[model samples]
Target chain A: MSGRTDTINELVRTPPTSFVDSLARARVRDRLVDGVAASVGDLPSGALVEVTLASIRRARSHPEALGQSEEPFAWKPVFVRRSLGLAAVRSCAEGRFALPSAAVGPVADQAVEEWERTGQRTFHWEPWFAGLGVGGRAVVLAEAAAWATSLWAAFDWTTLNSQVRIGGMDDLWTCPAPRTVRLKGRSEVRTRLDMVVDGRRIAGSDGGPSALVSVSGGVPSEGWREDLAYLALVAGLRAPDRPVPARVVGLWPDAAEERTVEIDEAALDGAVDRVVATVAMTAAAARSTSDDRPGCTSDSGTLVGSAAA
Target chain B: MAGPVAGPVAGPVAGHVAGPGTSGSTPWSASWQPLAGAALLERLRVTGRPRPAADPVLSSDLRSFLESGLCEVLVEAAGSGLVVTQGRLTRALTCRAHRMDDQSAEHEFTIPLATSALIDVLFRQLVTTGSIDDPMADALDGLSLDAHRAPLVDWMHGLAQAERRELRSEVERQADGLRQRWPALDPSWLPRTQTPLRAVLAGGQIDLSVYVDLVIGRPAADVASVAFVDVRSGARRPGHRDDRHLGALVEALRAPAPPFAVATYYTKTGELDVDPVDSDLLVAAARRCLAGIRAMDSLGRGEEPEGTGSESCTMCAMGLSGEPTPATASIGAISNVAEAILHVAEARVVAPSTQTYAQGQAA
Candidate 1:
């Protein structure tokens, strides 16, 4: 009475149902699964090695390298030199060096005692005698002097506070160094800069109404203020209200005040029009380069005197 | 779904239902009338409702089950009484002893997974010991307590733990034997939650804190009331035991804070309180916690197991718990499991300059 007989014969097919399609389809599906699993098993060894190497690199092997190194000078400028024979310039302006640490009373305590005797707010000196194990203090002292020259290119008299010695200490050997000084055994480097300030507008030594804005960039590219918009505003040659297509850096010294926005040379016709539309400008002037050698790589400029002041 | 013949319909009236004379109904025709209508109604009835366990099983032979798949009479039986219920799947703890979270727990705390093998192997240990727990700690505790049986104890213990996770050891053992036989068979299982540090730092995953808010259930209240009245005390009000204290706990459980992890800091001596979270909030918290773990993974990122030179590393399980030493961030110390073992790694984050670092303290 039931219709199970035909359906049962159809349901329990082994090799072929009607010998044409079902057998062929079953073979295709089984083959596909085998192929997928087999391919999954064959992952390459090169990819494994890449992952292993990457993990190792991420852990970091080196102890001394801080952040990233950028361009020609890989390290931060620890010392700035103006003329020569000055104290060192240090990039770490806010921190104090720890004492050699083996000392019984700790270096800070001993330095505080020395500061009490000296009666000054700041102190600048290195060890005269290499009585301690620090025999190579001279190497540190020399670098500090080089830094002093560069930093003091803008300032003549760097302060010396005896009381706030290197991290609250005053002993030449045991003490901390002053926050803003490069010291070599009580000697300080002083370099003079000539600045002309009329009310607020600062002029250069050559009687030009220009302010030296020193822009120091650090390695791995981050310490140079990342905001290009802010930088364009300060550079004054270009106002960044829109995308101007090309990046520009303007450097001028002892030149007439740029009354007009200067354009770069060899521009296609639409380039000047784009600059006028994008950058804050008076009438556009013919593009000129700043000095080629010592001061700048730009040729003939009455358009820029940028910072590094 | 084979159909009627594709040839022309040149016979009776095209719209009429089937009748006896034109098709020449056999003697079984009258019987099939009610049966056919009944079959149609039966299919319609069974659409949403289950088949009432009247669905045939081993009792049905090929002739009996016209639609059910069977060649010879089926052997396996699933009778009408085979209905499984929710209570069978779920379990609850008989011992209501609360677990001690790290901060509130006693210093130098020791936990003995109490009772005979019945309790230790079968019950509390089920909740406490697993790959989810510290395997090394579990192994050490097992060895110390039942080291005499040695190989036998370990075998039994492994079996019990495997059963706890509802995985049969025989399956793994069979796989192991197969792998041994087939030298090229490489079987590796990775945790679902753990992605590499690069992926986490690059925001490869959708940020956990954002989507985790879609936890199961309605949103909870923000303000929490923590009442400290004990009805058991003579001086305390009895009504507070049920009304206020539990009321607060139930509310807190349902509606935890926005920042899922909040330290309940006591003002007097800088102590902390861990509040109970609602079931839904807990689930949401669990997923969001993965992000914090992802963050920790990035900060320590490819961190070496060696001393971070911080005093906090003292409590690090990845570091030797008893003694601090330089070592490879020993074999997957940065894994999610390691983060759980070193719960303090998530709990306490102290930020100080190199000078004020706790490790810099006088030895």
Candidate 2:
């Protein structure tokens, strides 16, 4: 329990309550804003995804350079299992389908039936399903059942408002900047928390408080907090109206624990700074790779090098 | 599951009568065309003008006929308590007329389940936000994911990089087309999508259900004011008229007042076919529903209805035995794989959440 509390505390600071304390909180928010803006302000617009990809590529290319061991180069495929599992959870929450545990056999059958019928083959698992042996197919279904069961057991879904829309997989927000640079945010579950007035539930708005749920394995050692922050930033920027996410929850189902990051003005600032730093690293790596190319002319190379610098 | 009960024939029963025209080839301009929203309601008002109370003996005879003929089918279909939905009823009626075998019946069931899932997701997004920013991405987003072994996930994982890219591109194109052609529904009309309507029959032994894709106007409003819209994935089928009629039935059963209109929108063709709801239409729909229940009862009793000898009968599973159609092939491949998965899941059955079940009961 202490470990879980520590995890949550790492991301969200206690809110100031008193009038005098509120001013102190505002000052903290302003300082964070200034710091974050300065970091990401210089990058060309619409480069967030490019920069994020570049950072991963760079990390892959020179693991030793970042004090890490190197691994063979392979495309890190998108996790379809996580997406499907989240969807099942959402469907259950929305009462569209009975939870997997109620009838695992039927639930799994229907899920696969839907995937096939819909002609969805974009997932990395598509090929795996095609080549799967009988035993492999069984294993896949077993895993689906287990995953769905775990999600079903995790929360008290009945307490949530009946009108609350449970969205899974497809929540994406994009904010375009100068130079065609854009920042995108993806959340596994974007639950628009319902407002209760006199014990009656009302629909949530774009500006209303939302809880962004991200599914992952165990907490990562590097940039984990920033990762959540980055997600918050994208959600804030992409929000069609006012009031971005009030909090982000990262669920590690394997560990059966979750980390919550409260989004204050300061948190937003921190997220932007992290994005800017990642973009800068990507830009630097791109420049170095071009400089090392044999076909590059020295005069033109310097210009490229100077621009990167 | 007894054989159909033999009884004296009553005067011109409901389902036996010829329904309004549903032929896709015939031009709609040939006769009375479907009326749009407000106009349809106005027509209903005129046609449904209150009449003198009917003879008590006649009303009693009609009720008895409905109970014995229709209730028997519903009770049999709900054997051990199965939910009977509008879709299921529609299938029973269509299959009975076509004399479809068990295989064809199952295939028909699979098609709509799949299509409805896709349409439901899209409709949810539209009603929630009033627009879709990225159709392809949104559709993909609706899929559930997990990190462990899941057939769909595994299949997605196994896709070659190029193949994955190609799939995404195609999805984007289709999504874009859907978004561009999506009807401009006013959000203020209180548009709601995938709304579930349920009514129990045969003393709650059978649950007759229907899900309207997009419903405009509020629940408390006059029934004639609310518009019930059904979204179809492909071009309008001859059976679509039955589906619209079912919509009318759903409205009549659930809402205090009959709906203003019932319509179907074909996603591919971007055509909306609106039918006005009148007392006569409701009666017709009620008769069709009773016929469907009766058919289900016959099937339970191992009695197959005679085929109508329509051209559509050519596609029935009874006559077709050679190479599988594309739909059949795809469904077979997928269902086989899904059946395998279900076998494993069944072996490791987990206890369902009591709270969730209780919540469902509450709903």
Query: Which candidate wins on TM-score?
Result: 2
DockQ versus reference, model 2:
0.02
Shift of residue B170 alpha carbon in model 2, Å: 6.4
DockQ-based CAPRI category assigned to the predicted complex of candidate 1:
incorrect
Residue range with the least summed lDDT across 10 consecutive positions in model 2 chain B: B1-10
lDDT of 1 by residue, A192-227 (tens): 112334644221222111111221211111112212
Per-candidate TM-score against the hidden true structure = 0.14, 0.37
Superposed model 2: Cα runs more than 4 Å off: A1-309, B1-65, B71-79, B95-119, B145-174, B220-223, B306-363
Instruction: Give candidate 1 regions above 4 Å deviation.
Output: A1-23, A26-309, B1-120, B124-280, B283-288, B299-363
Q: How would you encode candidate 2's per-residue C-alpha lDDT over A1-309 as one tens digit per residue?
A: 122233333222222111112343345435434443444444333223232322432343343242222243322123333444555566677677655423333444555665678866534455455444333333343344345544444344554435234443343433233222344455655555555568676655554566666655422324456667667666555543545566777765433346666667666566666655554454454345445653332322122111100
- Give every candidate's TM-score on chain A: 0.20, 0.62
lDDT of each: 0.20, 0.45
Query: Per candidate, chain B TM-score?
Result: 0.18, 0.58
